[model samples]
Target: MSYSTLSSRTVLVTGATSGIGQETARQLAERGATVLLHGRTAEEARAAADRLIATTDVEPRQLHTYSADFAHLDKVETLARQVAAEHPHLDVLVNNAGIAAPERHTVTADGNEVAFQVNFLAHYLLTCLLEPALTSDPGGRVVNVSSALHRTGSIQWSDPNRTRRYTRVAAYAQSQLALTVFAADQRVTAVSVHPGVCDTALLPLYAHKGISPAEGAANVVRLCDPAVEIVNGAYYDRATRVEPAQAATEDRTVKRLNKLADLLVSRSAA
Candidate 1:
């Protein structure tokens, strides 16, 4: 699919150092979009950017790199600020950075579960901060890289942060669920996507069963296409729109999650 509309647009893809995110950046650049490839560190980001420029036919000037550790909310804030300052307008924001179920439960310096922060909250805060840039254009889109596993998740209101007890699967599900709900609640053209279990490092054991990173990225690139009109707040399974878990569709739940997310980000900034 040719995304001629993307020519001259600015896009930011988190987790572009590898997997679906990297492929998504490459494909977008091929469509003539200026891509901001994000990684956890400057070296990682630069390396990824260089590889894209060298391997793809896209011009070197079309690719840029930015780095921030999502585990620390403060760093996420810094990333948002830097992007806003550097780019006058952001046409697309791909919240593709994520971690799968970890073998052991871990907490970040921000006092939140690692999966929750990295997979959901960081993108939430980043999108909030970048709203101005996104809305500056008429067709601004925020494509959140979510998962079909979100159907298995329910918010643990009692322990949303997983401070008391934690399981890798539960934490991962909850984070993705929150992300879907946030997409639903956002006023902008935001939508969540399930890349259909790509073979990424996030799930090494399941690598044999899932599709290739390029296939997963195709679905994401489709959503970013300016010609496609997105059903605001909907969850997509590749090219098809599918229903998420019942909890993800509840208005009360979406509101609650948004409130909690705001509080978390505000606290981290403080």
Candidate 2:
């Protein structure tokens, strides 16, 4: 894509403290977009921005740092409000923040599985809260950094947190499945992507070795480009657009996931 194509565009990338999220922020900044770098903490966000400025031609003005702990729905709400108030005309939202499920069952203080809440629930709440700002412009869109493992997953509608039975891989895959299903929501122009098994903190969940985060990030950045026309709910494996798991593309699943997410976040469907 042309470097100038992203000029004046404002993109928010969550979990930008390291790995693919950080690299996505770096690449977007290099492409001349105003990048809002989000981290689990303020310090991490600032550090990511510092590293980007020091290593690349990105200037401080081209980066903004934001932080919120996704394990808490309240923090996610606060983050949405902050971003919307400061940058009311956001161009893209890259939901790249995620975590691997623990070997043992665990739940956040919000009473949900750790990985599910951090990976999907938080993004759901953030996206809904930012709908006004996202819809302010015609081409505004959301890119969900989902995973290939979603195909191995199924949502336990009755026990989303897997309170009855839980395994780390199953928990993580379920989160990714929910994220992919969420892209089908008609509330925003959105798509989901499996950026390949990149060498990141979550790599242990996939394999021992993998591609670089920068390589994985390029695939994500491509979808964020306004020059690239995309159909809402499209799913890509790396750069190739392919059909997602059958349930992910179903309208019933989309609505069902949205309803579940709304109840989990303790908010009405937006």
Give the clash count for each candidate. Answer: 0, 0
In candidate 1, what are the lDDT values of residues 44-140, reduced to their tens digit? Answer: 9999989987887889899889999999999999999999999968999999999875778788898888889999989999998888888546668
Q: State the displacement of the C-alpha of residue 197, model 1, in Å, after optimal TM-score superposition.
A: 1.2
Candidate 2 lDDT over 184-204, as tens digits, reads 899899999999999999999
Candidate number of the best lDDT:
2
Cα lDDT of model 1 overall? 0.87
**Which residue pairs in candidate 1 collide?**
none
**CA lDDT scores, all candidates in order:** 0.87, 0.93
lDDT of 2: 0.93
Off by over 4 Å in 1: 2-5, 204-207, 267-270
- In Å, residue 142's CA in model 2 sits off its true spot by 0.2
